[model samples]
Target: MQTWDVIVIGAGPVGENVAERVVASGLSAVIIEAELVGGECSYWACMPSKALLRSGHARRAAAHVRGTGVHEPTGPGAGPDVAEVLARRTSFTSGWDDSGQVEWLQGVGVDLIRGHGRLAGDRVVEVSTANGTDRLQARCAVVVCTGSDAHVPDALAAVSPWTSREATSVEEVPGRLAIVGGGVVGTEMATAYRDLGADVTMLVRGQVLAGQEPFAGELVTASLTERGVDVRAGVTVVSATRDGGPSTPVRLTCDDGQVVEADEVLVATGRRPRTDDLGLSIVGLTDGQWLDVDDTLRVQGAQWLYAVGDVNHRALLTHQGKYQARAAGDVIVARARGTEVLAGQWQRHAATADHRSVPQVVFTDPEVASVGLTAAVAREAGHAVRVVDYDLGAVAGAALHADGYGGRARMVVDTDRQVLLGVTFVGPDVAELLHAATVAVVGEVPIERLWHAVPAYPTISEVWLRLLETFGREG
Candidate 1:
């Protein structure tokens, strides 16, 4: 039996972070991964997807710089260089190789076992590698960072539709592409392929970016339509049929009696946690369900078993998962050392940020960045909330960013606590402005104290001052 202080299943970002934490704390750890060490974010989801979106967004921003004569011509010549963009995207993915990631793990003193890892029992993991099956024991903790797989409905799965992996890594852009969801992946992919010179259509069963503020969806939808994308919302795909050949087209019939034919269909509905084959039954746990964890990211009924990343179902975002992993690792180290630990909210060993201040950024034409709770959610949770809206175009920095800058900023305040409950920014290049909001929300900075933190006159961040002023006036 191979023994280690900790055993991490799935060497994705979350697993890597957890292993790093444990190893840095003077504990030995081993990472078992069936695929590439860098996992989905490095190869397909975040890196490649952002690579595909950045060029188009930058070019659009440059085009918006029309008033500044320093900018170049703004028409057909201003379009993105598709070949160059794809080459850069390939570079971002390291051509889909993970040698660098493996080297980094080795450098950090984390052992790597290439295989499928499953829970055999408490503190015991069974790894199936090419050589044979190996039983491993974790003296401290067995962390499950197995992540998630893109969900494809049975109806669409039978048609062999493309998920996020195919959409982010495709060599050639299809002449016509149909995206099956209006969520972040679907909307971002729609923008990417359309900018890449494909005839793209999005079939959304609900509003685009349904998680964000309503105006966010409206703005993105407008931007997409302006870019010649057919975004059909409130439309469900009843069935999908595709020819057996790779070059053949796919036919999708919607509930609205609409038939859409595309050279390729991309399904971006949701994700399913990778728990079914993890041998959870051996530990008195069910297979194929989202693992529930406490604030410390330890599985509800298991002391030494921890589930981080998307599998835990705390927050399915990569960054949020990393946060959980860090906390969980700290908790494990503390417990192993028999040290007194505080698992309270906002403590070093608790994932309080996951509950109260998770941040998310949607990289579309006009980006959307949000942190903390929305007004509706705050009110739903019975908090006395106040919402303030500000026009991005009114900000001097925004005017300098583009000719006709259009965007909105909103802040949800807790009337009782006098702190920011949430903040949402929607505009070009607004993703950079999100971290400040995240800090404010996470730290629970009081509204009165926020006023003392002055914003430089001409930056887009001045909108913060405006929002505060508006709230002051209303209050």
Candidate 2:
């Protein structure tokens, strides 16, 4: 039996951040990982997917420029360098190696247990290792940062369709690919594979990017359609069949009685919190359900247990998970030291940001970035809200960015408080411009204060200025 001050059950980004924070506070910590130490985002979801998307974005950016360096259309309809894009993705993922991550873990003085870890009881964890089973105990905290797994439809799962893992890490692009879903994962993957020279079709059961501002979805759908992706909205896949293994083509029958054939099919339906086998029932909780946690990120029923990241279901994005992890770790350390933990919103030991300012970016061709509550949500929350819109294309910076630039910007303001409640940006290369909006929303900067923070000349950020002006003009 081995004992540590803290034990983290998953070594994904959120878990790593938790361990780092606890260890930095002078607590001994151990991270138990069954698979790669860096987890899904490092290799499959975030890194590789972004690597795959960047080349196409860069090519389009260059092609739009009138300079000599503009990418001349090559091949049929001027396609991207598929071979180079895949190779770059491989490089970004370090050929799927976790050695660098392991080395960093070691350097941070956080011990690692390479096995499957589950709660044996209160502070006890039983790990199943290749050598044998081992019982480990944590004196301070046992954090479940197990993250989530791709949620695939039972009908499609039977056909062994690709999830985000296979979609991002695929070695070869299929000639024809079908993506079933219109959310972030499905739309992003559709953009990536289609740009990688595959004939892509997307079957969306709901409106594309359903939860975001409608225009965000509309713009993404327009771009995907203009790029030759067959996007079928309001269509659900009733069944899918593939018998000849992974290489075999998958035939999907939709609810609308439409049959689509593809060399490969990817199901990006949703995600399920990974809490089924973590022995949650032993802790007086239901199995296979998202863990409920307080503002301090401590499990509601169990005082010593904490659940962060997707497991808590607060926000599923990687950065938001990391944000939660930081607060959770600090709370654990404060309790261990017998210090009073701050419970105020946005305090050091509270995950207030998860509620009010969770920012997200979808890395499609025309990127989508949003933070805080939309106008509909703000109104639903009982806020007297005013909305503002700006044409990103009309901004001097956007026009200078590319020929025939197009995009839209929106802001939802709390009229009673004179502060921003939400902001959304949809356009080319807008991913980099999200932080400014995030700060505005999170800081709750008043509309009057915002007017003085002048945007530099001819920049897409000028859209911020335009949005504020629009709000004033409307008022």
Candidate 3:
């Protein structure tokens, strides 16, 4: 039996952050991982997905500019060499290896156990390794950071549809790819495969990028259409089946009685917590359910148990998960040493941003970047809100960035407080403009004070100035 100050299940980015933070605060920590130490984002989701999309984005950006001798590929064998792109993507994942990640953990004084970990009881984790079973105990806390898994509906199960994992790590681009769902994953893979020369079709039950500002999805839909994707909105797949072997094409029958065939089908509908087999029943929590946590990330009714990251269902993005991990780790340290815990909103030991100021970027052709509440959400939250819109294409920097720059920017302000509640940008390279907006929203900077934070000339960031101008100086 081994013991540590903290035991973290799953060595993903979220787990790594928690373990590292706790160790740095004079506590011993150990991470137990069943797969790669770096988890989903490092190997399957974020790194590889972004790597696959970046080549296409660069190609399009260069093709849009007048000079630099870049042109759209003309022949059947033209466009980005798919082999090279996959190679680059693989490199980012270190060929799906986690040796470096393991080394980093060791360097930071965090021990690791290569196995499956489950809660045996309060602060007790039973790890099943190749050798045998070992019981490890945490003197302070046991944190669940197992993250999430892609969800494929039962109707599509027979078709063996690809999830985000398979899509990002695919070796070869399909001749035809059908994507169901128009959220971030579906839209991104559609862009990547289309740019790699696949005949892409998207069947979306509702608008793409549904939770974001409607205009963002509208613009992304337009861009995807112009780039030769067949986007069918308001379409639902009633059933899907593959007739033959793994190489066989998939047949999708839609609710509208439209049948679609594709060499590959990717279902990017949603995610569910990976908690079914973690022995939650031993701790009085249900299996296969999201673990509920307070602002400090402590599992409700369980003082020695904590759930961070996607397992808590509070902001599923990797960055947000890490943010929660930092707070959770620090607060655990404070509690263990009998020190003061600043648990107030926006305090050092609180994850307030998960509710009020989360920032997200979708790496599609015209990237979608947003932070904080949407205008509708702010109003629904009982805030008197004002929405300001600006034409991103008209911004001088946007015009200079690309010849046919086209996009939009929106700011949702709390009229009663005269502070920004949210900001959304939909355009090429607008992702670079998000942090400034995130700071403003998270800091709750007054509208008048923002006037002094001038943006540099002729950059996409100039949209900030334009947004403030549209909002006006007066109440």
| Model 1 TM-score on a 0 to 1 scale | 0.97
By summed lDDT, the worst window of 10 consecutive residues in model 3 runs over 72-81
Candidate 1 clashes between residue pairs 3 or more apart in a chain or in different chains? none
What's the count of clashing pairs in each model shown? 0, 1, 0
Which candidate leads the pack in lDDT? Answer: 3
> Could you give the candidate ranking by TM-score, starting with the highest?
3, 2, 1
Model 1 misplacement above 4 A: 67-78
lDDT: worst 10-residue window of model 1 = 68-77
| Residue pairs with backbone atoms closer than 3 Å in model 2 (clashes) | 397-458
Which tens-of-lDDT digit does each residue in 1-475 have in candidate 3? 7999999999999999999999999999999999999999999999999999998899879988998689876555577889999999999999989999999999999999999999998789999999999999899999999999999999898877899999999998899999999999999999999988899999999999999999989999999998789999999999988889678999999999999999999999999999988999877889899999999999998999999999999999999999999999999999999999999989999999999799999999899999999998888899999999999999999899999899999999998899999999999998988999999999999999999998889788888888888888534
What's the lDDT for candidate 1?
Answer: 0.91
- Candidate achieving higher TM-score, 1 or 3: 3
Error of 1 at 210 (Å): 0.8
